[model samples]
Target: MSTLTPGEQAVMSRFDLGWPESDIAADLSISFARTRAIISTFDSNPAHDRHREAQIRRGSQRLLARLRKAGGHR
Candidate 1:
């Protein structure tokens, strides 16, 4: 796994919540330009991309399981 700075982690977490880059930047007290740079940095790293994808998939699966257990389905 790639080591992320706390700020980067905060950006990624905000992304997971579906926040726009501008909003994430604002919330993190960073500029939009910096946010774009951060995203570009993340995109350039294969290991980080794979790790993030795995984490997202795992979270989705867990949410699905919980929803199923609660008798919710599409």
Candidate 2:
């Protein structure tokens, strides 16, 4: 159960992907202050943390599979 709005989710997703706040703000076309404010207020829910961890694991697995298929792995 996410309490964040769609825009917030997008911001957080990019943030999780290691994007800088400036980059996120520029990409999203939002003000830097707004981006900082949103990030500052990010809540730490255990469920959300677990969900994000699972998503990262799944993405890593898929990337590894694609690399293997493309002979990109050593």
Candidate 3:
């Protein structure tokens, strides 16, 4: 996939990293309410959905690897 736009990447990464809306707003030099709306947009976007799914897959793979290293099974 192509690289994300600065705004798209920032919003997605901030939300993915579990940042507070206020922090995202302050960092992006935007207002708190505008940040909230941006978060809402990110939540419903298909492009962001693809990023979220990739993250989930990577996380699950890492968890499985760690479990395997510990000789654990599901």
Q: Estimated TM-score per prediction? A: 0.52, 0.54, 0.47
lDDT of 1 by residue, 1-74 (tens): 68999988888778777799999998889999988777756655688788777988999999999999999956
Task: Give the Cα lDDT of each candidate.
Answer: 0.83, 0.85, 0.80
In model 3, how large is the Cα lDDT of residue 19? 94
For model 1, what is the C-alpha lDDT against the true structure? 0.83
Model 3, 1-74: lDDT tens per residue?
Answer: 45667876787689788899889888988788877766665576788678778988999999999999999956
Q: Which stretches of candidate 2 lie above 4 Å from their native place?
A: 43-74
**Model 1 regions lying over 4 Å from their true place:** 43-74
In order, what is each prediction's RMSD in angstroms? Answer: 11.4, 11.2, 10.7
- Best-to-worst ranking by lDDT: 2, 1, 3
Best by lDDT: 2
Candidate 2: pairs in clash = none
The residue-by-residue lDDT of candidate 2 on 1-74, one tens digit each, is 54899889888888888899999999999999998777655736577678778988999999999999999989
Number of the top-ranking candidate, with TM-score as the measure: 2
